[model samples]
Target chain A: MRTARKPLTAAGLLWGVVILTAVLACSILAGLSTGGGEGGLRELLFPAAGDGDGTRQILLQVRLPRVLLAALIGGALTVAGAVFQALLRNPLADPFVLGVSGGASIGSVLAVLAGIGGTGAGMAFGLDGRMLFAFLGALGALILIEKIATVDGSMSVYTLLLTGAIFNAFSGALIYFLQSIASLEQLHDIVFSLMGHVPSTGFGTVAVLAIGILAAVLYLFLQARDYNAMTLGEEGATQLGVDVERVKRRTFVLGSLLTGLAVSVAGLVGFIGLVVPHMLRLVLGPDHRMLIPCSFLGGASFLVLADLLARTVILPGELPVGVITALVGGPFFLYLLRTRRTGHEFR
Target chain B: MRPALILLAILSAACSNNLQEQKPDPVSPKDGLRLVVVSPSAAEMLAELGMLERIVGIGDFVSRPPGLNRLPRVGPYNAPNIEKVLDLRADILVTVRSEAARASNARLRDLGVEVLELDTSHWEGTRQALRTLGDRLDLGESAGEILASLDEAMTTIRQRAEGSPSPKVLFVVGRDPLYVAGPGSHIDAMIQTAGGTNIAADSDSPYQLVSLETMLQRLPEVIIDTSDNGPDALRGRLPGPWDTWDFLPAVRENRVFWIDPDLLVIPGIRLPAMTERMGRLIHPEIFGDPVEADFEPSPEPGPTETTIEDSP
Candidate 1:
């Protein structure tokens, strides 16, 4: 049976890109313009004194790197979510749904407690002990989760989600135990490491992160067609000459890489993975090709705006961007759940 | 013109007279003032002023001045029991200014109890708070006497500490995540006043999470651990963590001393005593050894339950 094509044609894709770019541009310009006290966002962005002034230096040197990091993390997370949902054939699957974030956090938190990465000051450029440990943790979790949930080379989605959820709980409790024994100074580092904020790093560090995320995301985008085929059920995709196992494995590893990078670089800003892709799916339809790129752009816009709110809403003190995303995403998730029918399965 | 000049002279004399009258009285009378004190340190300050009897309601943490534990408990320092506070007919409720007490402070005011928030987070603030609390209780002259002595003691310490090599000191508040009293902290000020440099003095925060490696590299000559597992509390035991880093000067020379949290941790009226004790720890040659009050006597205790500070 030939179904109808959705509205997301080339022209629609162009329009979406244009609008997202506009949103991003507007957000970047306005990020430092809110809150009217001393060191107001406006003064920081456009210092009345010359560009070499401290305010401008802070805006460019400190805030800009973090802002860019947030956008990159958001895009990476959403793209990973889209890939996971397609490969697992589960709409509920998000980048963090498989407990990858939990694993990454444990490694980083332990490193933070051990005085790795040079205190709370964020000194990692590439493959620092914290990031390396986090990568190892994420890789470890991926392998373990895959091993436990697979039977006869056929992975059960139900077991996969359940294993991921339980692993997350176990990791969380482990972090708490570690936290209890850490020094009071180490306690703050542990809590903040898990609390999830975009730490301000230099351009060299940002470029390294940008390249890693971009490479992983582009690799996933290349597998979009295989994802589209897998959406036609495992047996159906196999009959259509697609290697279902290979696709699943590749998606799993690539998605895990994206998630590991997100957590290790910026801590644990969750809900972007769940919220951004789900929203994009509704608006852009299930076609993997357009959805992948769109999720990246849309997610970038969403997080930049959310981070702007996180930084400005409290004035001087910042609410965690994770809190902002969850506040917005949790209710939206509930609305989606209530509106959708149960037990039908997406395929 | 003569009349105008005479009127202007009279006006100037009257203004001068008004200014003199407005000058604060050296001693204010405490006329049976009813009070409810929420902060333990604030209660200690009042007790120093001999106004502890006036505190009809006291916070849960106020376990000082040897007595006054018998007063009606008004709950924790942050959230005082509104019913108990009002029930005691307290004219004023004095508390430390804190984020934890924001809602409680407002709620007490709503219940018709007068509230005064005093900032006693630092040594400077402690003196001002005591004076303010004294003024609140109408006992300014008594607080003034205590302030004068505190000022004199600090001045003496500062003078003697001058021209001497001030060794860097690390004041550890906890372990695992390693909380330290950083720059702008009350403990940092005490370290400076006691003729030592805080190793974390340049850090932006008052109390901050720090790296153990950084602390080791800084090589503090003196280490003050305020963790509860001290020799007094732990049957003549040393904290297990400090021994791991033998390379540290503090650990090597055995300058790491454990002190009572109540005396040092809480910034209060007891700063003079705390300062003197810290001085002895940092510069024993100049200021002499610290006194340790034995809380528990061991059955066959070696060397009479004395603290390391008191050891000759």
Candidate 2:
């Protein structure tokens, strides 16, 4: 048992480092290659006065920050997904299964329609009150769903997922009603916000997100052994001396918090959270010790690459980052669903 | 003297009675046609020409020209409520852009309603539509006068700005996918007429998606975003996506201005006023001389000495 554990732990750590390196390299390369062919390797390395030119500035300032933000959000969301799935012992669960994204969207639309985002103080913080309200809404939804899904002093994954779907539908109906009353300008703002364009926020905001996500990941990782045991059914894990309830409560709060933060910042960047954790699981096996950290790095790299393609696919015009993710991830998800029928029930 | 006063009083009474009996009602056209205008601007123009009473129905979106509220709404411009139009027994249906509402227009025509399709998406098109409408409505003289004044305004702006250096302007219509007005759009034409060059005017399409990279390369002197109503849609608000490039003149001088899209984009009688505003925005030095007409002019007296307001 000791010999088996040592290799698994080393392999997990190695893969984690490898993915982090790959993501960093891709982000830098993508930052340089965006804009046009003008920002080649020579321009990236030297950046001469003439060579640095207008195109280089676009690649660095506009595209670079956008790519970095995508990476941070993607990583954060996927890690949250892995944690939620392990906590519930359900492979079908995704980051948005808690209805955080839906709540955030409603709050964003309200902020935009109210015209609060246009105030001077609203603009100074880089993220307008729209984003703040979205975060608060996300937190509210997480708490509401958690309370409803819990019965007889314990949480049920089945109840949680069902309630989440219902809450999402309710939020969608509310958004449509808001759209009907919104002016044309407000409609534009709401549509774009929900469609998930990562507007270039300040580095400070990105750093805050990165720190928040990383802290959550680290906390979850420390509970990795408990997660492994919880996979064997809650009663069985409790019989094995694991404090199942304490683990469940902590994971739910931390996991949902990370998910809410990501959704608030990036809108609903679909598929990454749902698919990345599963894909990492296939490679690293069912161990949360290996799957959780590796999923974060892999997801970040995937999104950074996706965002690069979104910007450069049509020069002088960009496709929304959400479009890029769904276009690629949708087909892959279908393939996974079709080929893999393990029927390994998750909770 | 008493006999003269009694004779004068008897004559005044007879004259006053005759005047009350005549009433001086303005005659309707030879056809006595009842029209329904589906476009808001058309409704406003028709109302301005003393033809509001002739309009038996209007589109639901027609909010301007306050008296129109009492008129029956016939759905939106693109999809007119056919039942309402038919029920009102409208003889003629006025709409903008025949192609925009082809099915609705065809349906109206099929129902024996005369559909007058007007293309008022540009200045010249709007002028032509006005003249055609006037000819059809038998208000040719008023239409001719309105067209003449519009011409006078355009000529004044052209002469003032013809020799001046035109500023390179970027007219952003939307931000997140970054849409700009290209050649053939009314906004593009207005920019050209107002002695400013639209950077996106060279695009093949009427409206094209421009990249932030291209915008930075162009480095326009003025950035005017007619994205929406407020300052958030303006050029300098958070600089969200464009903050990275400090070399942009618009960024450096904070020359980004936001105008109401309705005022700048909608093609109507407001084009002259729109161009004048653009001229002032682009080259304030030359066309800064403000021309203020009483937008609410005193009511003119009709031929028989009745106020135009009282004609109906």
Candidate 3:
């Protein structure tokens, strides 16, 4: 039993970190390799060769920023997913599992209908309407779900999850209603926003996104010990000097914030939140301290690679990043479920 | 050049070998040449040729001279009702070109209904459509006359634009998700003809979603909102969120204008008129004051002008 547990310990966590860093680096190189192949990824590494051509502009301006945004969003979502699973103690817990995606979708659809398809619906005080509205929608969903789920000043994880599920269903129906009334142009925007993509952003936007995601993720990381105690059950966590209720509220809000930012920038990319943390937990033990950062790196790598596949698989016309996530993650998730049930692994 | 010659060679050989499927109908002057046009601009084109009297069935989006509303709507531009068309005893049908949307054109053709699907979606297509419809309907001489008059108007508009201050313009096509008439679009051509540069002319598509950041950065001098919900609905929704971007010159100067899609959206032989109107909208000083032309642009009334409040 002791030998069997070796990989799920500190040593394994260290190796996992190293492995994830490598994967992220490789994924960035691999992503950069696909588009604007004037001199390839190596030339990009060498500034001299990568400059003075359209390929250079395409690589640095378009491809690099896209990959960076994908990585940031993916990492943020994975960290949030890890925290949520630890909080809810549900195997199926993901960012969207709590109505975050539904709220963002509503906001995005509203933007489409208002004639701000690819652009921000409006801008006020430097906050874009599309991003601001989506974040507000996410926060709104959180409040509504929490209000419905909480009873006697105590929150039930099951009720919280259920309320989220119902809200998401309600949002889906409402989106269908909106789509039914929309013009063909608006309808196209609605479909694409809901379908979700890792859209290209300016370097300035990418920098802001990366910094914001990093802040949120680092905040989540501060609560890793609490999340670790969380895996021992809420009572167990409380017994270990953790403020269980405060931790829950903070993590829920923080996780939803991460989800909102991700969705606003990249649309509804799925699976990274659900699958990345679980995979990390299996290899690095249920230690949130290690799992959180690993999840970020692994998730970043996973999304960068997935986004790479999305753009290249179809060539000029690309599949939505969400489609790629669902396609690649769906079967792997099923396999995890099937094997975990059969093999009794990583409880 | 070589490909054209080969195409010509193939066409001559094919035509000489009697491989043509299209046959003219046996409608005499007494029958008045029954026609069913499944597009608004096509209906407008026929109206330009003085053939509006022959149109028996119109499409859903064909809003004009208040009488066509009484004529049976075949369907949306693409999926027209063949049953109703046959019931109306229409000898020929004209529609737009979008591959899958109008795929039923093949079935309509197979059913012995002469389906003339034209690329009447852009300026070039509109020009060609005029000549083709004229030749097809034996009104080629009339088509020539209309083309000449339109050309004259275009030349005047071009000369008006020449050396004039061409302000940066943004043409909004849809609002909810911020789509614009980009490069290769009829709207783009109109903007170019009207002494304004389309800021979105660099986009790869004819119509595409543009980022608001790009718009603010581009800082358009004039913004034209062409998104038509309905006449009444649009009037209520006229001052859309465009004012929020007060940093934009268009918003700062209140140069933003809402032209009904009826006058602008439908690309056809009305290119000259549409281009001139766009000129007036974008470069009022260069093109002179804007004339509120006949809003009900139909040459002849169909029967009832039911405003198409389409949802489904």
Candidate 4:
């Protein structure tokens, strides 16, 4: 079993969390202060007596919810990535790679195809039809993947990986089929929904997402020690008295929940799950306890800043936030691979 | 001397036969030209030209001029079936210019099909396309009459709209992520012709995925929304979704319109009609309020053919 290169000191962990918290706060501030609207940091900082209500509405109602949604989605995907990496003991495992995102996408696309996309009959829990369908799709995918990968009550990581790969391919084909049958208007809606842009939502949506994401992250964090052990392989973790099966199942469910929430709200914002966790792991060692919390804060900061750039890059015209993240993450990920000789640090 | 005379007579007969063969076929009205029209705009134009009978096959998207509904569908404009086009024995395949359909168009052309790639996205393009279609189909007189009517209708609307206050109008094409009809689009042209200022005139492209906050800040006085096409989508003037932004002048004044995209979105021989509908939206006082039929999709089949909406 691989041990931590450096001892886990409380002070070091506390400082990492503190620094990330500060970074996240700064990112949120920057996101709030900047946008395509007339309001800016200067306008926000000094409210003139003649300032129109439009500027205030733009700042509060428009930018705030979007910023909060980005932060929540970013944090959730990043934490989910870190947990999946630990449980699967694979450096490349992410929500997208594990097929959870594909399932949620299928559900969302199906909802859109059913003409329930922006305006349909409201469902239970104040959730829109699309979001509800997406969450259900994620849950269904998680169960299906778990059932298929498990043989004789024991799940093999290799089998799980293969199942995920196959499922994702199937999902992609199915989405294309759905697109082919849709009308021109529906096609446009589907294409835009699939491309990762944070929807302009209300505070109610932000609050719901926050509660769900926080609850899931906390539950996953409690299993951090089991995740750390599982990284040493299933047999090794068993030898260490860890309930490997239980931990794996819990991680998969919780991680998928995080992915579903993010994707349901913000379409498919790629790279946050894959890039942020790996980045945090490289800097903070392969320890799950520190990595989980730090990943949440760091990922939130990264996405908030990415979203800020996405909205501001073209002035009046906005590029999808997914485009910005992938553009930045793809190159950074390649650089990490090239420079990190051995690649054992990830394991 | 008899042999020389016989040779000259044979040479003269041969020359006469050659001249007869080289003479062009006589051009006539409604000359037999088997056309396969894939573009809805082209189909609409052909119907107006009284040449719908010449169309052998229709495309998947051509729902208008219900007389063509009985014809075989050759597939969508971008991915037309080459076999179907050949089987129909089409003399000309009329379609809109699409980058995605380039390969299929090339294959069809190579297989001895005359492809007429028309542009109906703008007013000038529409006029040029109509003229070209007329000349090719030998229906120049019919096409000319349609053009005159279109120009006369447009001139009347423009003249009536003149000296009116140009209300700031927002033409929303999509809501989720907020796509808008910016400057240079057909909608933009209609808004200007209707004497309404386009809120998105400064945007870079004809169709742009715009910033919602920025768009809202512009404070449009009139909002024409054709974004929702779902079966359950609320129709007519209603603040279905725009209720969230009640501060918007459009929402506050109950000027948020939820009309069928077919009424104003599609550019074709319907430009003058579409522009008049737009005038109604921008200046309800002059052009009159948009009636219930304006918010509904064009009725299909049976040839009732409700092309223009009622004036309220």
Candidate maximizing lDDT: 4
Per-residue alpha-carbon lDDT of model 1 for B114-218, expressed as tens digits?
777665666777787777766755677888998998889788887877777899898876443355677655678888988899988865466654544346556
Which pairs, if any, clash in model 4?
none
True contacts kept of each: 0.00, 0.24, 0.00, 0.47
Off by over 4 Å in 4: A1-4, A41-53, A114-117, A120-126, A139-167, A183-188, A336-344, B1-32, B298-312
- Candidate 1 residue runs with Cα over 4 Å from true position: A1-4, A7-12, A32-53, A113-115, A118-127, A183-185, A341-347, B1-312
Q: What lDDT tens digits, residue by residue, belong to model 1 across residues A1-347?
A: 02556645778777776777787767665654432123446665456755322344445555577678778888888888888788777766775767877887888877776667323233545445677667667767877887998899888887888898899999999898886576544554565567666665668767987888888888887877788788888898899888888887777777777777778767777768778877777766777777788888778778878877775564323466788888887787667557644512554
Residue-level lDDT of model 2, residues A94-129, one tens digit each, is 656557678777777777777764222255435566
Across A165-268, the per-residue lDDT of candidate 4 in tens digits comes to 89999999999998777665566667766879987787887888899899988888788788888777889899999998788778877887888888877888
Model 3 lDDT per residue over B1-312, tens place: 111211121222222221222344444334567788876667767777767777888866665535556788886654677788888887788776534444677777778777766665566666677787787888889889988888888889988888988899988765534557776667788899888999888765666655433454567888888554432333322346676455567877777776655566656667787898788778778766665452224554332222222101
All candidates' lDDT scores? 0.67, 0.67, 0.69, 0.78
Using DockQ as the measure, which candidate wins?
Answer: 4
Tens digits of lDDT, candidate 3, A118-186: 344343432455665566677777778878988987667768878988999998999888876776435
True-structure Cα RMSD, model 1: 15.0
- Candidates 3 and 4 compared: the better one by lDDT is 4
lDDT of 2: 0.67
Residue B103, candidate 1: alpha-carbon lDDT: 89
- How well docked is model 3, in DockQ terms? 0.06
